[model samples]
Target: MPLRPSRDVFITCAVTGAGDTTSRSDKVPVTPHEIADAAVEAARAGAAIAHIHVRDPKTGRPSRDLELYREVVEKIRASGVDVVLNLTAGAGGDLVLGSPEAPLPPDPAGTDMAGAGERLAHVAALLPEICTLDCGTMNFGEGDYVMTNTPAMLKAMAARIRELGVRPEIEIFDTGHLVLAKWLKDQGLIADPVMVQLCMGIPWGAPDDLGSLLAMTANLPDDWTFSAFSIGRNQLPYAGLALAAGGNIRVGLEDNIWLKKGVLASNGDLVERAVAIAEAMGSRVMTPGEVREKLKLERRW
Candidate 1:
């Protein structure tokens, strides 16, 4: 397929992820209030969507608490932020093996496994306009850790998400995951205007090189709406690449922390940079309403 650049692009800021980056950068939001503020800030900076993940206020660790998510959602709603809320449903599938020799008993502390319903508890309660769906399981990083999302789990979750009338941003870490997404659509679980996030540069997943990115975009169905991002330094650079690939852009503190060599970035800063890059490339940054129409999202509130 030839390179067809995007003319109207939407930006999704993955505000704060469920990563161990709080200690590394003070900019990572921990409390519910902080996360909501980050989302609002990103919205003001021209992001069409805010992808959220809550954290333990005291420990700064990732959390799946319903109350915490409630506070964040309520705060953002109360703030009158017009950005589309995209809550994460990717938290409860972490698995860490015990050891190479003793891999039977997985480490309880590092492993967090839950059923489809339990995993998407917050989404069921809050009814965000969009939520993520990890299409397949893979080794997330260097360790016994694996991001486990079985076909059964994804099918159940996708069915429930469809019933809720929320669009699923299928998280594609590798090319195989894209195949699984197609299968889900074939199964009639994923509906029209399929949205996908081509997550790149993560260890044990697809590399951040241009060749890998082109290969991923080439396989995508023409009708599907997609976005791509690479972590670390490539995160900002991928803004141009994504535009050239005829997809949207994703950038925020969740993917990368640095604004420059020694600068730590907030969600808003990353989003501002993305807007500038998109505009520089002669693409218009879409608003929340435009994105909703583009994705055919059903906003809960």
Candidate 2:
């Protein structure tokens, strides 16, 4: 894909992800109040959207508690921040197997598989403007674990999301994932002007390189709206890269924990840095209202 150099771009700040990062950094928000506060702060720092995932307040472990999500959404809504809310429907599909010899019985502690409706309980309840649909399954990290989202599962989840009148942000971890997203669109499971998030540089997934980014973007449908992001050190660079590629940008603690080496970053700090990068490249950072208009989002709250 050519570098189109967008004049105006929107930023999505993934406030807190369903990851084990809380143990590594003190800034990771674990409680609902903390997550809501971080999301509002990111919006104030010029993020058009807040991609949120809640964790167990006491244990700091990723959770699928509907109450937790409800609290977070309620708090953010009450704060009156004009930010698009994109909730995660990517949890509850973690499949951790036992040793190769004992793979038949999955690891009880690490495995968390749920039905489509169960996984989307919170999204169905809160009716956020947007929710994510992880496009495909993959070996998530260095382990016997697999992030399992079968085709049937995805179809069901996408149908429910559409029925609820919420836009599904198709999250692609690799080229194949993008292909699957297109297939879903063709099947009419996904709506028009699809929104995609090209997630790069996670273990066992697409590398965060210019060539890889270009390949992913090049394959996207012309009418689709997209954003691209990479994790850790590559996060900041991808901000300018995505804007230059005529796409939007995403940044936050969910993807990276640092503002720089040896420094932990808050969600606001990441959004602030992304805003600077976009502006330096002569691109204007868009507001939530602008993004909602562009994406045709129906804000249920």
Candidate 3:
């Protein structure tokens, strides 16, 4: 398929991920109030959607605390910002095994395995406009950590999200994941007009290469609406590449820390940079209402 340039594009700012990056840069928002403030700032800076993940306020580690998510969502709603909410349902799947010799037992400190229902607790409670559904399992990073999302787990989560009237952003890290996502859609588990996020350059997943990106996009169903992103320095470049590939864009501290070399970025700063890149490429940055209309998203709150 040929690369098609998108005239109008929407930006999704993954405000704060569940990564352990708080110590690396003080800009990574940890507290609920700080996360909410960062989301609002990104909205004010031209992001149509804010993909959020709350952390432990004291340790700055990723947390699945329902109360923390509640506080963050409430704050964002009360701030009067019109950003569409996209909460992360990708947590509670981290599994860090023990040493190769003793791999039977999982590492407690690194393992955070929970049931599908537990993972969707916050999403069910808050009912954001969109929540992610990690389409496949893979080795996440250097350690023995594996991001585990079984087929059954994904089906249950997708059904729950559909019941709550929220859209599922099918997150695909590789070509096989894209295949599985298509299978899920064909199985009638996922809703129509499937929304996908092509996550690139994450350690052992899909590499940030033009060929890989092209192959992934080529396999996507023509009717699907998708966005693509890469981490670190490739983030900005992929913003234009995704738009040129006829998809939306995503950026924030969750994916990259630097606005430029040696300069740590906030969520707003990343969104601002993404907006500049998209517009300079002749793609108009879409507003929250425009994104909602295009995605056919229903905001329960």
Best by lDDT: 1
Candidate lDDT (C-alpha), each: 0.94, 0.92, 0.91
Candidate 2: lDDT over CA atoms? 0.92
lDDT of 2 at 65: 96
Q: State every prediction's TM-score relative to the real structure.
A: 0.99, 0.98, 0.98
Number of colliding residue pairs in model 3 = 0
Predicted candidate 2 versus true structure: per-residue lDDT over 54-140, tens digit per residue:
998989989989999999999999998889999999889999999988897999998999999999999988999999999999997
Whole-model lDDT for model 1 versus the true structure? 0.94
* Span of 10 residues, lowest total lDDT, candidate 3: 292-301
User: Which sections of candidate 2 miss by over 4 Å?
Assistant: none
TM-score of 2: 0.98
Q: RMSD (Cα, Å) of candidate 2?
A: 0.8
- What are the per-residue Cα lDDT tens digits for candidate 1 across 1-301? 6778999999999999998889999999999999999999999999999999999999999999999999999999999879899999999999999989999789998899999999989999999999999999999777899999999999999999999888999999999999999999999999999999999999989999999999998899889999999999999999999999999999998999999999999999999999999999999999999999989987777
Clashes of 1: 0
